[model samples]
Target: MSRRGYARADRPGRPATASAGSAPNTVYPARRSARACEGAAVGADIVIIGAGFAGAATAFHLARLGRTDVLIIEREASAGVHSSGRNAAIIREHADDAAEQALLHAGANVLRRGELAAFDRRGLFIVGPGQDEAARYCPRASGRGTWHPDDGTIDVSGLLGRYLEGQRVLYGVTVLDWTHGAHGLTVRTTEGDVDCRLLVNAAGPWAGEVGKLPLTPYNRHLMVSTPMPWVDGRWPVIWDGYRHFYFRPESGGLLFSCCDETPGRPGVYEEDPKILDTLQQRIETLQPALGAIAIRTTWVGQRTFAPDRRFVIGFDPRDERVFHVAGLGGHGVTASYAIGLRAAEIITGKLDGRDDPFGAGRLF
Candidate 1:
């Protein structure tokens, strides 16, 4: 959990106050300080403003492409504290449009089959209490086995660890402002200023505030149960129809979610007890035998979306130097790798135009 540096708020290149009688226009010499500001105007190759899965995965891909000198800024004390950490860690198949689904399928394959050090496919299962829900996702099922034969849970922590190991991530640093000029871009953060040739706005819920781009917020909640071993059998990742409720086994117990989507502010949130109560009622109606399960912990997180629910990946239509990788809705975690790689490809000129259906042009 320890990041590369301390989270102290210290401006990197700002000159200290001049002596009381010093001339107002006196240029401060850059060589006198412990960290010289001489190269402050020289920005990085790529500057990413968020450190979640999208940002981290982008950094990883950029490094893989031999593009180092990339900087990532995060506002939280640690990475993945927002939507990336709060997600249920489900690697789902294409459940949306063709483009979105194709990217998701490609991303899932990278996690399961790629030689990258960051992914592992322990297998995933989507189960329903009745036949209707099961039939909906049946086409995407892996032939490895059925829910009855094997548990459907994925190793979410393992997946995150694989991507984050030995990476250069700046945590607890908030971006204040950024500007694109003819030469390059300038990014101002709580600690210091960064200059980069390319900029990516993968700030998640706060992406809109960082720039002129548009992003909307949506809320989702999840609940964990007190220790009980009864429901610990081969637990298939259960989806309660399209209702915002799903359950997975964890630590000799069950983790349930109402899958509720309510309009709300964007940030970390405590789970609504009423929503939990409602979810429990729904679960009981689906399976009355497990009605008395006790709740252990509950929490909520914002899922940002664009005007269209599809993801918006690629440069701003007006400014190609400023890339966008936001509005992932609830599918950010599932689509993180693909979005990151696609964003990198667009940045490096390996791809022509945004191939995903969730490209940024939809908003315009």
Candidate 2:
């Protein structure tokens, strides 16, 4: 699916360069020619770096608040090509942190409203040991669990489209560096330099480098099985909290993950073959009833996290003009709308998240 613009990259407004033959697992953004933005506007009231879920959703909320003159710069040729496009697309709002859970609830409500995209609402069944209530949610589940009839999947690309509609996004534009001074913030990119009153770093995996904050990007693997006639398409998503794995019906088959997290850098990801063995082991041990499953496709995506694991939103403590809408981690999909709304509220003075759980000050 095509995004409003190209995919976003890491290292927004930060001075960075990729060297030849860099580490295979760590990728860096390379500087591009300024010609990319030759005919586009070089100035805006707000310049947001990256067009993934964070940027798109923030732009969407800003427009709702009647704020225009926002320009989004993405390094990739399309949006959601990174983590936003690579998630499981599930909307389970059960988070260990209450602050994040609240955002997840708001975001899930946004999806169910049907304004952004189509939602499945197939429900979600979370299972763990000793609960003995798994059967309540999934008849096939053993042990204890809870059934959330509101949790389900969404059309991620379509949601991105809706959030980005009527927004000005410049794809294939790389942010070289940015500086904030008396004239406001000047962001230099491959397209050219743009002057803005505020600069938002929503560079996803690149957020750490872009905002100079403490964040790490971890890689996770997902696999889809070949179509199985016996597989039921209506089965609600089943997650095992103890086993650290989840699976749901997909395309007449099953899409599963072992929930493996490996620290890595940005850029392209090559599927790690070793994860297949890990997946098999987990499935055999935790979900053997499904029998042998043949994989049809596999992929790896990155999720960025703060040291505390809570989201890092609000303005940077070091630079108030440079705002942040990153560190959503894997919760980006489940909490995107609320994240954007919170960010917009903070930016427009409707609210201040600086001291809240999702605030950026805590990290400093």
Candidate 3:
């Protein structure tokens, strides 16, 4: 790979150091040791693995609900090591799944309300065939589609910081294995064993492996063009809903994706350059008025989902102590706040999710 390739590759897939102006590093207390069977090196009432959107958002809500005895373990040195950090950071509420859409609406509302900083609220336009209703919102848009007045791009890192604010997270701690006991559970990690009454598997792309679930991770690519002077940064995100392609003004240019999905393993993504050709072909066929695009950089990211493509958020049937908040697919950012709130409610016994569309029972 070339120098630029190394830089872009580090963006979405590889586990690299936090970028400048990203989350600041925090010092964790020294690790303590305890008897293997009798106790644990660390202890908490709840232990969540993976400090990505799922884990951070859940912890945030748990704190909001007055539950402070929580601990988050992250394999990477910082949060959003994988998909959470690599995503395009667009907040779109429309979805084919009613359940997912509900969460998207709730979560996107929170983001759009200025609860967090670094949001470009230019709005979004989903242009497609027979989207007369959508066209009403973005009449100035070049094509007909639904207009999402609140939809726009966000500074993902800054948003992540808000979710992790005042949260107790231990970075660089990898969960090796865990054993559940009559009393609670003991999680074995690279740092040491952590004992907790409840465990959450929100490891994003690695959630399937961490929680022993059957979640699948798909690789997708994103490209940013060199500075396009004619591009209007205030323009809404223009997306071809039916064609699975979208683009928005970014850094004086445009960022786009073909919405390609290919099965992939956790943390292992190989950028397929051929996809650029596909993107070009789609752009030419769908909307060529913008003229030729000079690409600057490209990267690949992962999106995990269940076989049914619905979210998995409930206790594992095999073990009540283990809860899952995985499989948000590419909607993790847009749905994080709602997901965390709902997961916190269910985890705290305030809600029974066995019948919920996103419940883990459906997976069994």
Candidate with the greatest TM-score versus the true structure: 2
lDDT of 3: 0.77
Q: Candidates 1 and 3: which is better by lDDT?
A: 3
Best by lDDT: 2
Q: What is the lDDT of residue 333 in candidate 2?
A: 84
Candidate 1's residue-wise lDDT over 1-364, tens digit each?
A: 1223332122222323323222111121112232333333334688888777777777777777878777667777555666776677666664657878887777766665544433333334444343443322333222222243222334443444445544444566677887767788877877667777888888888876665667877777767777785664444565544545567665567767777877776674645659867876877665454658887666777888777677888888888778888888877767677887887787787877664465677677
* Candidate 3: segments with Cα more than 4 A from true spot: 1-41, 131-142
Tell me the lDDT of model 1 at 299. Answer: 71
Q: Which ten residues in a row have the lowest lDDT in candidate 2?
A: 18-27
* lDDT digits (tens) for residues 118-215 of candidate 3: 77788878787545543344333356666677888777766777777766666666888899787999989876677899999998999999888889
Which regions of candidate 2 are displaced past 4 Å? 1-40, 129-141
- TM-score: model 1 vs. ground truth: 0.79
Off by over 4 Å in 1: 1-42, 114-152, 268-270, 354-356
Q: What is the C-alpha RMSD of each candidate to the true structure, in Å?
A: 11.0, 7.1, 7.4
Candidate 3's TM-score reads 0.86
Model 3 has how many clashing residue pairs? 3
